[model samples]
Target chain A: MTGVLLPLLSFFFAASIVSLGWADMLIIVIYFLLVLGIGYYLMHFTKTGDDFFLAGRKMTMWIAGLAFISANLGSLELMGWAASAYQYGILATHWYWIGAIPAMLFLGIIMMPFYYISKTHSVPGYLKLRYGESSRMLAAISFALMTVLMSGVNMFAMALVMKVVIGWDINVSIWVSSITVMVYVVLGGLLSAIFNEVLQFMLIWFGALLVPIIGLVEVGGWSGMVAKIHQNFPAGDYTHLWSTLGHFKDNPMGIQWIGIVFGLGFVVSFGYWTTDFLVVQRVLSAKDLRSAKMAPIIGSAFKMMVPFIVILPGLLGLAVMPGLVGQNQAAMTGAQSYNEILPLMMARYLGPGLLGLGVTALIAGFMSGMAGNVTAFSTVWTYDIYKPLHLAATKREVADAHYVKVGRWATFIGVVISIGTAYLVQSAASIMDYVQALFSFFIAPLFGTVILGMLWKRATASGGFWGLLAGTASSIGMWIWVRIDPSALRIIAGSPDAKAMAEDMYRGLWSWVICVVVTIIVSYSTQPKAEAELVGLVRGCTDLPSEGHLPLVKRPIFWAGLILVAFIILQIIFW
Target chain B: MADEKLKSDSRATDSPERISIWFFIGAVLLVYGIIILIASIPGVSSPEGAQHVMLADLHAGIWWGALLIVLGAVYVAIFRPGRKKD
Candidate 1:
């Protein structure tokens, strides 16, 4: 949710930016009907808890792969990153390339086998297997709370975007979108969510691709774009990716190389891609081990192409619409906010039919994001929190049918809670800033604990729990410290010129470091679990399945290597 | 017991009656492509119909709409559910 709204919190629009025609309204209405139709069609197949939670563990590689990438391709990401590109130039592409591709490939090649073989339903379930009940409980409660709150954040953000973009009423946007998402999700669960995500993925590409295509044509081409930007800001460097990163003040983003490399590329990116259950749940639905292993590789291939639609449009805005102001100045001077670039570009280029398609695509992005969060929230709430608590209190195992019923109820309840959160956010806008900050506290430390438990046989359960606790506490402490004293940003980010984004990266790095250090120290002091009990859960004790007998073209490692080569080539081309 | 049940549930997903997700994608795209293609015809006849966007002469709606139609048709043909052999 923070990922969707973090860059957009400053936006405050006084009037509608664009008006939609009948063609646009028709396209959006068609999208709503199709999603609900999918849910109603799939309802018959959603008979058991497994089907509702994990898509019956039966998705093909292409389906799961597309859904995995699409789940993260929310409207906030599209608009927010486009704004970032306008604000920071081509440096924003780093968030897509170095920040995402490596982490996704790492998840596919290094981390997937354990997750696939263990048959864990969620990330917290994996923790339960490796770190005991207490660790699982801690991870599950925090994750469940965070996921629902984030859903609410996405909901409110979508409503706000609608009210600003086409003058839709905020209450109408909130209720209509919320009810549509709730009906589909409650009817079909994860399968419905995954299916809609795939559809949303296609819609986003088709609807938004024209903006860059038209923008590039107007500016001439790539060289023409570079020249126009150069003409616009002669003293600043916007076209080059790596040349201006020698110092904090040298770059438009005020970020240094170390923060980009370690803080974002290594810590924050890995933490989100490798461990976030909203995305990982999609991969877990793959039919077999090989499919699971290949899914993220497929996702990364598509992920590399996303910057063409997202980042290029922002850079194009910088070239074509050079006088856009920051949100603060926009409110005072009545100039366009940088956040309005995507819709502005859409309105500038798209005609009647195409304009409708673009609007539908934005709506699809928002709903897909909402469905992803709600589905993941319901699964975690049911499996990790509710089922365990019910078992402990009643001392009996529930029937599969009963659990499936409970899951449906959880789905409905989760959506209601999310709608409530959206209204709360509407009443108090500053809640978004606090919620976004609170989200960063868990991810880095959770990654540290999970990765340690998976790889190191010596990591004790006590170490995992205590390390996670300490890391989270310290992250919150650091956020408060920086909040109370603005000068503390320099200490945290390692430079006086460091900006807000740099502070985030550096804080993630420090929290992760604290987690790893505390885990090792505590593990050495505690008694280790028996080696016999570690089979199938840790690296050395488990025998990995062989794929060497297959042809070279069929191996996951081959595709991963190909993706790595593509990633490096992109870096060189942009450099 | 729960694990065993989950393993068994995987078989249910392969039921012959289950519809392919691709077919829905293809169907939606085909409908959208047809509508846009028809809509672009008026634009081609009168410049006023194009809404005065950049590159109005290129008739992007015609090309883009035709491309979606062809792609959507192919996906529908290949992945249509209820076919016995799939």
Candidate 2:
């Protein structure tokens, strides 16, 4: 421990970092108190497992909508994407725009009706409704493992950021944050997490918006920033969105338009935004079908604006603050890492009170992220895993209170495991990367299984089970194959010069295709369920709820169309 | 029918009596805004750390803080606990 502490202390000390003032400290303390207060307040209302896991299905559109996006807007995403913008240029906006908006809108306009109508407690629960037990258990086990590991990743990243930015001890940051999250989530469950996520959304926008606002002011404006970037790197075309993507080697990111469109836009984005339970759970808390559908649409609208605070800072760094380098280079030469661009910009512009708010926003982001994962983990554990085993043992239904009790315990145990995972990540950074990638491996295949089960009535239980298994296996196999032989990248990504990001996109596309094809083949060979059993589970058999009485302006499809128009306009403007 | 039953059952058990989430958001923002406004007062010496940033004279804290206070005020007024819904 002493040996680890010595090197870590020296590394952080060598970096020039800022300290917080009294006002900053006061603001942060207030936020911590407020979150815990929310938990205590909500504890009174939380009696059943429904209240603990699904917020009693009573969240308004705006509340659920803000939280739906906020759950994804973590410090890891904020810092990582900002760094990507700095390194890869405005092309990074593709992740927010093309990659996310389409899928979110699809979730609202197309997919949400099914999820809302089924009234299943979870995505895995829906799988059980449609396919059978095996598929649900597989998904639940994978989701539970991934969610807790991700909570740990968020915890470790928060500690690392605090240590780098304000010189806080790693252990102190990790434990304080983990304990805070555990207290609130164990107290009130998903509602507590949702409340904190909404607060986090507001704080992130208000706290970080100044960077892009002041940055654009300092660099003249968008045109000026673009010109300055062009001047800085005469050979690099950093500003154009789609114009530079004629070939893999044409852009700094080494990705082509095809990968952007099909791989990321269709496969990876849909898999995450549509199927991933963490974000989906937020929308599931909506009071009605319209609100549920509107939630993801509202989320997409907010998501489209995230690039201004995130990607704009990285672009601004390129225009103004040069000399930021890659991580290994930064460590070797005492230069700033691109990942530190967000904090460095905050330091450059924000003063005492605002600095504290900025830092608090980051802390809120990390905590909300941890809370989201932990709460989701607890829900899946109790509903999908623990309850099943208990029922098998007792052969009887337990009281709702018993499951609620189990959820609280699961929340505690999940946080403890996450802490252990965080410490493990601290020891081996590579473990964090693999865990994140491993989580991604499940997403594409899961999306395929869920979508097929929802859309096609012929999708058999065996087909859903085997298809998901094969898809996940193939994704892992491809990852290992590429890791073993560097030359396999040409076959996987279709370009010799394609970067790691492109590899991820293509991998998702292939795995999803494999899952779909296998499901069709196996589904044909296996016995299909009777039409009577398919109601409310598969699309054609289910009579979807009608919102035709709503005005055009109030309809989710209308707003989805408008959002799509705005999304296209953004692409053209950025291009 | 089942979905409606679930919705009404859950609604009957929760919703109306609980404290509003918006109130908490408003309260936090209001306090933070006031703190920031106080810190940004003219002739208050700038912190040792922020002395060198460009546009220091622009006083972004004042504008942002005022915006927050106004937004916070509206949220608190509209959604404060025990206020009757229209």
Candidate 3:
């Protein structure tokens, strides 16, 4: 262990020695100032809760699409996936493709119209419209709490990156990021967050593009990377996507393709990409129903390419970086302790100016993620929680500006709470474990409930409430059972892997099954609202607006179809 | 009662004049240009006196900066505000 520690320490020391120059610092400062300026400039536009929370529903398809993906392009999506790529190899691309693409496209085609036509400010608001107060309150409170915790996770991740890369004190890193995020979010609300996210999206691509480009250049090209990876790690099948993924024992992921297909691709990915309010809020802010429908489709196109930016870096780390793939590193830190793969690559490949831009991209990713969470949290808290409670007590209608004021306060309070949560997460041995657990508890179950309510007119409000409760409870129970008796997971999850991610995927699948079953059983027993009452809320009952006289090629369906084709082509090529 | 409140609250706000997508694209180019240009300047150093290297040998910051500036100029010119009036 000490042998591993010594080398790891030496590696970190060597990487940290490459400090930022004056130009780098200047560029970072300019980036921050520009972000703040955007917030201040947009403040005039944010007059009411409508504008504050949903950008006055005036976002174009391009803005909505970029922001949709950008909101998810946080520290975790960047660093965690890169780390996964390094650890799990090309199999990590599944999270972007089979895991995300289908769900996002489904959302654009099947779900966005209801959300747009219903005109709800948040996901919880949608629930209240379709179900009742019970379901809405449960979802709102849980979602609000989860967003803050997720934001803290981003904060902790950014601080960890700074400590590893530049050797900054974690506390200073946390404070600087928290303050910067709080300023923009509080000043301009969702619009500011989305605008900055669009900018960060561009920066992430430009900055991280160098790694794969330069790394591929160094290794010759695509074929060269595969050959080098094969030579370096003879025991690992790093290149094959679906062919070698037949059984748990067949691949490094240590799970069957069925589990990957059903658990991650169907349950967890659909849960997150389709229902998670963080990305949904971006689409909900679109100028028109058409733009809202187009947003996720456009986002799916970009999301498909994300593996190159995130996963490719990890593959490069394995092929290039020495002492990263040995038994000691894997034993001490699962997956070769390649969490710092991204920063290490940046330190090595980027000269001076580009280096600053790369680091700024990291910062931008962290802040954008933090901002996404806080803005989403504030919207939910103010609209779904505080305002509803206030109305219940006062029995009066408050002005839209009153809600806007509450949103600002919520943003401030949310950031402070997130800062506290970030410190709390410091005690955890693994941040990824905690986050994945949170997702299983909240996201998967919520997806089950939302999908049922959206698709079926017969689903009762009481059913939605009880179904959500049962799903969450089952997920927790399964997690505890797995913890106490490691063997128990094998019954449901098929063969268990040593990796937590595989377990998480299986847990999500089981929880979703429980939720759906309970919802159906309870719904049949209870009285459902009449079809007349459920008109716009349920599919088949509602008449979806026609795609405005636009040509076939210009319509969202055409683009979505093209994306689906591209997805299949890539899968086949990678396979 | 709740439905009524939702209806009242969700009234569509007036549609503002369309802001051309080019504006955002131009703004991004301008920011990237400035950063690249500043970083490409010579004699920039760390506090420890380590010199910074240029990103590329072809005066990358200068050329990219100039090109982006021109592109931004063209975009802003073509899609300038109040073009609908014309």
Candidate 4:
């Protein structure tokens, strides 16, 4: 009874807020239909575990490229990204430009060389061949855990953002949206994921692109925003860039550039670009070896500009409501909560007609990310863990053969778990932060072990096995320290208007250090494994594409050029 | 297929072809370096940085779209798809 009536009731409420009932309902219904219809259509393309997991390894670099971009786009980006940029100050801005851009190129030029040569369906399965079974299983389990937890975070975020905008029950938003996203995602697996992502990317890019342009025109002009920013902030507040980083009572901006650029950025950049199943699967699904390698770079180049779509609006929103945003401690924490900034801004500002599109843009972003997450989870589980442990069919795991049906079921289960988790995740932190904090527990450890396994052949099975355990435990401990520490948690929980620099440092710096230190120490203490077995997995003869890998000579040339070019560009910006 | 192979960035004629890979990588690196340099500057700000952050904000469409076209060109060149024996 509630299921049918609630969304309808919510639809009317949504319609009434903007005062255009039928048109908005029609747009939402049509968009939902289009997603389901296309998802079902893409499902027809799946034939085997590889087909389900890797889209039969026949995706064009362009489609795969678009899908790769879509994997990063989620409903949360509009609000979450803008909110973070609005609150976190400038250095946090490095993630998209410096981090994502380089990370993509690295994956294309380096990781692709190995993936193409090895022809492994799963990223972790390659680890098994390169390191041992222990590394493979450990990576696989960690990936599943990360995906499930991340999905919950995504669901909670999607529901919360919509609830704030439409005044709907969070429960109604979760199941309705999750079930809809799951239907198409499960029906086709990566095929559906790629298909939906292509559409989602197109819409999200358009939707986000529309916001600042519309918001700017509607409010006043570009200079008008600057005037407003000054009006809202104290005289000196709107004038300083790096001042936000230094302005913390407890320093909510986080530990300086080292933590922001390298520690936090490097760890996350590598984890998502290299090891994450979602983005890797898109690259893996590329039509040929060259396309797979090139896909990430293509996607990344596009991502450099996402800050405009995502982060700028929050900053601009402050310009709209100068007196309301508050300054000093509240303002800095507002910057830290980052994800809440976008939706609240959108709800508070924007005209009715544009509001529909803003909401639509947010929906597209959510679907794109959710589609990426569930698809990756399905592929890693069905291909790596499930088939190896329970099923004994070699023919089923091949590039094109026997496991489509089961793979779809695995995707469905992943979606269900995601919905359950989403409902459980609280609205305390912005969706991205809550998800990131949880995901870092799983991902940070995996990042440490993978770097060791890839760079050092002597990294033993027992070493990787225990290294993963130690990394995860340490990350969780660091998170607890930040929370339970009388200083940080009190500030995070809003009990006191706190001022502690070390407390902010815990949020940004400590987790990555803990993971890297623990992983290296544990891996170093273990014995070496047989190098001969890892040969075909990381370096093989058969499928090696002549063109894809970054040539040895090319590296130094690029590094030097990068330094020179960066020098000139900065000279212009600064001088 | 022959034309595709001939024009392909990696399709160098033996050692000369392999050497150009270095050249291509160098060009790409130059783009990245430009970005880093922009950030490394002493007083350059961001979107919400003291200045209203509008230069990159307002013109992102022009730059990212134009950059996308340039990247798209690289992709289209790679995607031309050659015959196996060519």
Candidate 1 per-residue lDDT, tens place, A269-308, comes to 9999999999999999998888898989999999999989
Candidate 2: regions farther than 4 A off: A1-16, B1-14, B42-49
Write the residue-wise lDDT of candidate 2 on A1-575 in tens digits. Answer: 33554454344333346666667767877888888888888888788888899998888787789899999998888988999999999999999999999999989878888888989888998898889899999999999999999889878987988888878788888898899999999998898889889888999998899999999999899889988998998899888899998899999999999999999999999999999899999999998889899999989999999999999999999999877999999999988898889989998888768888988878888887888888889988999999888999999997999999999999999999999999999999999989999999999999999999988999999999999999999999999999999778789989898888898999999999999999999999999999899988888998987889988987999999999999999888878
Query: What interface-residue Cα RMSD does candidate 2 give after superposition?
Result: 5.2
| Ranked by lDDT, top first | 2, 1, 3, 4
Provide i-RMS per model in Å. 5.1, 5.2, 7.9, 14.4
Q: Which regions in candidate 1 have their CA more than 4 angstroms from the true location?
A: A1-15, B1-14
**Native A-B contacts reproduced, model 3:** 0.17
lDDT of 3 by residue, A72-156 (tens): 9986678888887888889999999999999999999999998889888888898999999989999999899888987887788
Q: What is the lDDT for A178 in model 3? A: 90
Model 4: docking quality category: incorrect
**Cα lDDT for residue A336, candidate 3:** 39
TM-score of 1: 0.95
RMSD of each: 5.8, 4.9, 7.2, 10.8
- lDDT, model 1, position A418: 86
lDDT at A32, model 3: 83
Q: For candidate 4, write residues A97-146 as lDDT tens digits.
A: 65566667767766676766678876787777666777788788878878
DockQ winner: 2
- Look at candidate 2 and tell me the lDDT of residue A86: 92
Clash pairs of candidate 2? Answer: none
| Clash counts for the predictions, in order | 1, 0, 0, 16
